[model samples]
Target chain A: MTHTEAGRYLRLVVAEEAPRTGDTPDSGARRVWEIAFGLAARRRFETDSPLAEIGRTVTAAVRSAALPLLEAEMLVREALGEQVPVDGIAESVRTAVHLLVFARLADELALTDDELDSLIAQAEELAAAGISPRSEPTGVP
Target chain B: MGQTGTLYTAAGRLLLDALGEKSPARSLSHCAGSPGAVRLLRELFTVAVRRGFVGRDPRDITAYVRDLLDYQSLPAGGEFARQAEAVMRSVLGEPEVAYAVSDRRRFELICLMVGDLVRPPGVPTGELVALMRQAERRAARS
Candidate 1:
C-alpha cells in the first residue's frame, strides 16, 4: 500500500465506516491499522488527564462499542506512550482496536471535519516520508 | 482433598507473601527463578481462574486484569498484558494461547493473577487456602 492508497483508505474508513467494494481485503486491512495507529500517535488528550483517566475513557468507549476489553487495554497503553506488541496480538483484536481507537480519539479531540481531514493528510505525508513502511504499516510514530 | 506436602506449603507461602506485600508484582520477580514455585503458581492460577471466572464471559478476565493493573498503578498494555490475558484464557480451555507467552513472563503473570485472587477485602484466606489445596491435589494427580 502506497502512501496515497493509505490516505484514501483512511478517508474511506473514517467517512464511510468501512472500506469500499473494490479495495483488496489485505491492503484495506493494513491501511486500517496504519491509519489508526498514525492517528493515535497524533492524538492529544487533555493536559490534565491522568493515565488512569485516559484508561477509563478508552475502556468505556471500547466497551460501549462492544469490542474486546483486551483491545481497549492495549489502546490505552499505546496512547500512554507504551510500545504495544501489535504483531503478537490477534488480527481480529488489532482490527477492532484500530477502528474503535480511531473513532474514540477523534471523538475525544472533537476534531472538525476539516481538522480530521488535515490529520489524515499529515498521516499521508508521514507515511510517504517513510515514518511507516508502505508494505508493512508499523504505525506513524 | 489432602494437600500435596511441600507443593502445598510452597503455594500457600507464595500466596500469603503476595497478599502481605505492598508490591506483589515486584516481589514476585524474586521468586521467578524458583522452578518449583513457578509450577505451583501456574497450577494455582489455573485453579483460580477456573473457580473464579468459569461460566462468565471470557472478557471478565480482561476487565479484571485491567482493574488489577489500575490498582497497582502498572501500565496496562504491551507484551505483559497480552501474555497475561493468554495465560488466563488458557486455563479457561483455550490452551493454545499459552504458547505465545514466554516462560519467565508467564510465571510472573501467574503469580500476579493467582495472588490477585485474594486481594485485601477480597477472597477470604480460609477459602483461598482450600482452593490452593484443591490445586495441589490436581497437580499431584497429573
Candidate 2:
C-alpha cells in the first residue's frame, strides 16, 4: 500500500455515504489526536493496561471541560517521568490514530471483509515506512 | 427517571420531533436559527447525556456538533472539539455509569454548560419556555 492508499480508501467509503451527512472534515485529524493520546496513556501507564482502563482515563480528561490534551500529557509525563518523547510519540500517534479511526469508520460504512483487509494492509505499510499519516493531505478543501 | 421526569419525557418527544426526517446537519441548522431550538439541542446533548439520558448516542451527537459548527460558521475540528467528541463517544459507549451532575431544578442547566463551551450564551428564556409548552401540547395531542 502506498502512503495515499488508506486515504483513498476513506474517500471511496465516503463516496458511498451521502456527502452532506458524511463525517466531518476534521474527523480524520481528530482521530489522530485521540490515537496519540490513547497510546501515550498506555505507554506512560501500564503496558498491559486494558483498553477500557485507558479509555476511562481518557474519557475523564475529556469531560473535565478543562484543557484535556494538557491534562492527558500531564498525566502521561507524571507517570512516565520526564524522559518521555512527546514529539516522537505524537509522530507515531498520527498513523496509529488513522488506523484506529478508519477501521471503525469502515465497519460503520459497511465495507466488506476484503475491503477492510486491504485498508489495514495499506495502514500497515504506512506505519512500517515511519510515515506519519498526518503527512497526507486530508483533502478537506 | 430523575426529578424532572415530566420535563425529560416532554423534551424527549420534542427532540425526536425536531430530528424527524432531517439529517443532523439540517436539524442543527434549524436550531441555529432559533434560540429555543439551540437551547434544547444544547441541553439534550450536554446536560442530558450527563444526567442519564439513556437514549443518548455519541455518533448522533457528533453529527449534531458537526452541524452546529457548520451552522455557526465556526471551525469544526479543534483540540477542544475533538476532545469533546471523544468524551461524548466514550460516555455513550460505556454501560451503567454514574452521571457527572444532577440538577433537575435548574432547567437551564444545559444552557449554562453549552454557554460556557460556546460563546454568546443563548438565553431566550421566553422562547425556550414557549417551545417547551408547544412540545408539551403536541405531546398531549399525540
Candidate 3:
C-alpha cells in the first residue's frame, strides 16, 4: 500500500483503538505541548505549534495510567533505539496498544475538564515531590 | 526465515499440546526448568497483560509480525541485508530479535518456542496446552 494508504490505515486503526483505550480527548495547551515535544523528540514535525502545552496534557494522561504509561514508555524507547519503521507492523502493534488504552479510558471515563485538570495538577505536585518511578511494577530488568 | 522443524519434533509437539488453550500453561518455567518454556510463558503473560483481544484479524497480526522481521536481522545477501538494516533502524524492538520473525514466521517461532518449552516435561505439556487453549478461547469469547 502507498504511504498515504498505510498512513490512513494507521490513523483508522488508531481511531478504533483510541476508543478501546478510552483516553480523554483534550485540546488543552498542555496536551498540544506534549504531543508537539514528543513529535520533536522523534524528529517529527506537527502543525500544532504549542508542543509544550501538549506535552503537559499528555503528562497528566500518562500519570493517570501509571503502569501502562511506563510499559508504553519503555516500549517506545526500545522502538526508537531499534528504529522501527514509522508504518511498519511492529510500530502499529505497539502504538495501537498505547493509543487504545489511553484513548479508550479517556473516552470511556469521560473525566470532566476540571477533574482532568486536577489530576494533572496532582501529578505535577507528585513530580515536584520527586515521585520517581511512580508505581513501578516489580520485574527483572 | 529458516523454519525450524523443531515443532514437529517430540519435544516441540509436546510443548504445543501443553501450552494449548485448554490448560493455559502456568509459568511453565517455574517447574519445567527450561529457558524455552520460561520465555514462552513470559511471552504469553506479556501478550495477555498488554494486548486486550489477540486481534481477531490474524492476517493483520501476521503482517505485523512480518513487518517486525524486517527489523531484527537479515539474510546474508546484499539486497536483503540492506533492507533488514533499514527496518532495524526504524521499527524493531529488543524482544523482536529473540522472536525475530514475520507472519508465518511468527507461527513457526512461537511453535518452536512452545515446542521446546513443553517437550522435556511431557505430562505437563498436555496439562499446559489445555490451559492455554482455555485462556485463548476465553479471550476470544470476551
Candidate 4:
C-alpha cells in the first residue's frame, strides 16, 4: 500500500472518529498496526516519570481492556522500549496490543488534542516520506 | 562452592535486611548500583523460587505477586508484575521469558521476589539458607 494510504488508514484507526471504508480488511489491519508501531516508536515516557511506573499504568490500562496477561505484558514491554519478540505472536493479538498500548500511552502522557494531532501528522509525514515505523529509533536502550 | 558461599552469605544478609524493613521490596533498591550484588540477588532469587514454589501452579505465583504488590500498595499489573512473574517462571523452567526484562528492572524484581520469599512468618532464615546451598550444589553438579 502507498504510504499516503497507510497514513490515512492510521489516522482513521487512531482517531476512530469516523468510519473507515475502501481498504480491504487485511490492508486496513496492517495499516492500523503500522500506525500503532509508529506511535510507540515515539518516546512518550521520557519525563521525570520512571519507566517502570509508566509501564504499570500502561499495563493496568491494557489489562482492564480484557487483553490476556501475557499479551498485556508484551505490550507494556514494547511501549517501555523493549525489543519484545513479536514475530511468533499472532497478527490479531499483535494488532490489539499495538492499538491498546498506543492509546494507553497517549492517555498516560495526557497529550493535548493538538499534540495528538501533531503526532498523527508527524506519523503521516513519515509514512508519506516512506519511513517504516520499525526503522524509527526508540528512546530506550 | 566458594563463590556460592559468598553469594549465600550475601543473600542471607539481604534477605534479613529486607525482612526487617517495613518496605521490603523498596529497600532492595540500594543493591541496584552494584552489578555483583544484583547478580548474587538474582541467583538467590532463583534458588528461593525454586525451593519455595517448584511444582506449584504457575498461577499461584501470579496470585502471590498480586498479593505482594497489593500489600505494598503498588500497582499489580505493569512491568513490575510482569517481571516478577517472568523471573519466577524463568527459575521454574521457562527461562526465555526472563530475557524480555531489562537488567535494572530484573534486578529490582529479583530483590522484590527474594524479599517476598522471606516476608514475616514465612521461611525461617536457616532453612532458607540451607535450601540455597542445596540448590547451588545441585546446579553446580549439573
Root mean square deviation (Cα) for candidate 2: 17.0
Q: Write the per-residue lDDT of candidate 4 for residues B1-142, one digit (tens) a residue.
A: 3334446545445545665687766776676765544555666677778777787655567667778878767777555776777877878876655776787777777767766766678687677767656545544444
Local accuracy of candidate 4 as per-residue lDDT tens digits, A1-141: 233454455455556553635534464445545555546535664322343465465556566656544555555445444544233455666666666666666666777766766676666666556655553324332
**What does candidate 2 score on TM?**
0.28
TM-score of chain B only, all predictions?
0.81, 0.31, 0.28, 0.75
Query: What does candidate 1's lDDT look like per residue over A47-99, in tens digits?
Result: 22344455555665566656655445545555444444333566656655665
Q: TM-score: which candidate is best?
A: 1
| Ranking of candidates on TM-score, top first | 1, 4, 2, 3
Clashing pairs in 1: none
Total backbone clashes of model 3? 57
* Weakest lDDT window of 10 consecutive positions for candidate 3 chain A: A132-141
How much is the lDDT of residue B17 in candidate 4?
Answer: 69
What DockQ class does candidate 4 belong to?
incorrect
For candidate 3, lDDT tens digit of each residue in A1-141?
A: 222222223234324531343443332322322232232223321222132333333344454544333234333322223222233224333443444333433343465545434433443344345443222222211
Clashing residue pairs found in predicted model 4: none
| Candidate 1's TM-score | 0.51
lDDT (Cα) of model 2: 0.40
lDDT tens per residue, model 3, B95-127: 322223344333333433333333334336445
Flag regions of model 1 displaced more than 4 Å: A1-141, B1-11
Scanning candidate 1 chain B in windows of ten residues, the lowest lDDT window is B1-10
RMSD (Cα, Å) for all candidates, in order, is: 10.7, 17.0, 17.2, 14.5
Per lDDT, what order, best first? 1, 4, 2, 3
Q: Estimate, for each residue in B1-142, the C-alpha lDDT of model 2 and write its tens digit.
A: 2114335443444454554433433444444545445555544444335543346433344455455455556545543333444445444554222232233312232332233232334335554444444444444443
